[model samples]
Target: MSEFLTWLFATLFVLVVIAWYLTYTAARLDRLHVRLSGTLAALDARLVRRAEAALELANSGLLDGATALILAGAASESLESPAEHGEARETAETELSEALELALTEPVVTHVRDSGPLGQEQLAKLASACTRVQLARRFHNDAVTDVRRVRRKWTIRVFRLAGHTPMPHTIEFDDQMPATLGV
Candidate 1:
């Protein structure tokens, strides 16, 4: 009878430990999801800000006609693209980054520098916005990676700890800024 009681107690203890572990994992996964969501929102805001800055620069009449047209078109496309989720939005953002790089050539940088305070300020804002986008993207991707790693664990799979949560994916795009932007 004592042996049976010991065995029963051990089994109960093991069950409790497993339950605790699963609960902890589930809570951690929830926190990671929240972090990913917040980071994505921040990344989107930075992208929008960068697009807005590019549009402003294009409309300022400080740049050449061709450069201004290119910048405006790219900025408009990025702004018009659906903010939800997909490769289309990522492509649009990459195009905008490319446009910014092409439009902000050395000669244009020199022109902006020579144009005085307002032009310099606009350039600075654009540079800052681009840098923010880069950082935000990195942070978001890191969060995605962490969540993915944790979700892939055997324990999580065996216990179905993640529930029905859809797998998260990393956001990838060319966020590199123009050399002339000094970012």
Candidate 2:
């Protein structure tokens, strides 16, 4: 009787411990997903702000007509891109980056800076927006990496601890600052 009781208690203890561990893991995973969602939202907001800044610069009477037209088109496309951080979004943002690179030659930037207070302010806003986008992307990607790492654990997969949470992917876009801005 004593031996049987000992075996029963031991089994119950092991089961309880397993249950606790699984619960902890699920809770941790849930927190990670929430963090990821927040980071993604932040990235989206930064992208929009960057696009708006570029659009404002394009229409600021700083650049030439053709340059402004090209920049405006790219910024509009970025602003209107689908909310998903998918390939289309990436392409639109990359196009905007390219357009910005072409439009903001060092001499042109210097010309804008010398134009007036508003020109300097517009360039500063654009520069700040661009920098924020880069930072937001990095922070978002780091969160994604954390979630992916946790999701890939053998226990998480085998036990389905993540439940129905969809996997998160890193947002990759051409967020590099223009050379003129970097300096």
Candidate 3:
């Protein structure tokens, strides 16, 4: 009887420990998800700001009509993209990045910088916006990577600690700064 009681108590103790570990894991995962959510929101805001800055530059008469039109169109498409339209949003952002790379040549950047104080300020704002977008995207992607690492754990999968939470995907878009505007 004494041995049986000892074995029962040990089993209950092990179960309690397992329950505690699972709870801790779930909480950690929940926090990571929340962090990922916040980072995504920040990334979205940075993207919108970047589009707005590009559009403003396009409309400021800094570039030739064709270049300006291309910039404006890409920026408009990015701005109009719905958040839930994941692939479409990514495509629009990629198009904007390509447009910026094509339009902001060294001479064009120099010309805009030398145009006047307002042009210089506008170009600076656009450059800053581009930098912010890059940083925000990196942060968001890092969060996704962290969450994915945790989600791949065997314990998480077997116990379904993540519940119905969808796996987070890293955002992949060309967010490189234009060569001439790397400032």
Candidate 4:
């Protein structure tokens, strides 16, 4: 009878340990999901800002307005949600490609025709702004990729069994670069 009691307690202890481990795993998954969510939000926001900057430049006649508007709209729409798969993400990628092509194409080259060249300082500033926008876009895309990759993991499925859905990371942009670099 004593042995039976010992075994019963052991069984209960084992069950409790299993429950605790599962709970811990679930919590960890939740934390990752949260991080992914925050990163995605930051990424989206940056993309929007970059797109806006491009649009502003284009509107000011430094770039083409049609291309800028298309790019802005594409970037804005891409933030609706994080793409679940390569195929899904490709759609936004294609739109971005189109905008980039338009922005860099013959129309801009032909429209901006003038005998006088831009001053060195003005050209440098424009180049710097363009580079910054490109970097921001890349940073945002990388964050989105990281989040999506985590969501696709098998462990995330286990977490789902415990009633956690991998939250899609949606990024938000900054109006201007804060002292800090993240979002």
Number of the top-ranking candidate, with lDDT as the measure: 1
- Model 2 worst lDDT run, 10 consecutive residues: 174-183
Q: State the TM-score for model 3.
A: 0.95
Q: RMSD to native for every prediction?
A: 1.1, 1.0, 1.3, 8.3
List the candidate 3 regions with Cα displacement exceeding 4 Å. none
The lDDT values for all models are: 0.94, 0.93, 0.93, 0.51
Instruction: Write the number of the candidate with greater TM-score, choosing between 1 and 3.
Output: 1
Candidate 1, residue 167: how far the Cα is off, in Å: 1.0
TM-score of every model versus the real structure: 0.96, 0.97, 0.95, 0.53
Give the alpha carbon lDDT tens digit for every residue of 60-116 in model 3. Answer: 998889889999999999999988637889999999999999988888899899999
| Model 4 C-alpha lDDT per residue in residues 1-183, reported as the tens digit of each score | 999999999999999997897677667656665665655555445444444544444455454456657755665554443544244554654454355455545445444433134422222333444456456555655665665665566765655633645444433332232111121
Q: After superposition, how far is residue 45 of candidate 4 from its true place, in Å?
A: 0.5
Candidate 1 lDDT tens digits, 1-183: 999999999999999999998899999999999999999999999999999999999998899999999999999999999997589999999999999989999989889878998899889999999999999999999999999999999999998888898998988889999999893
Model 4 TM-score is 0.53
Pick by lDDT: 3 or 4, better one: 3
For model 3, state the Cα shift of residue 60 in Å: 1.4
lDDT of 2: 0.93
lDDT comparing candidate 1 with the true structure:
0.94
RMSD of 2: 1.0
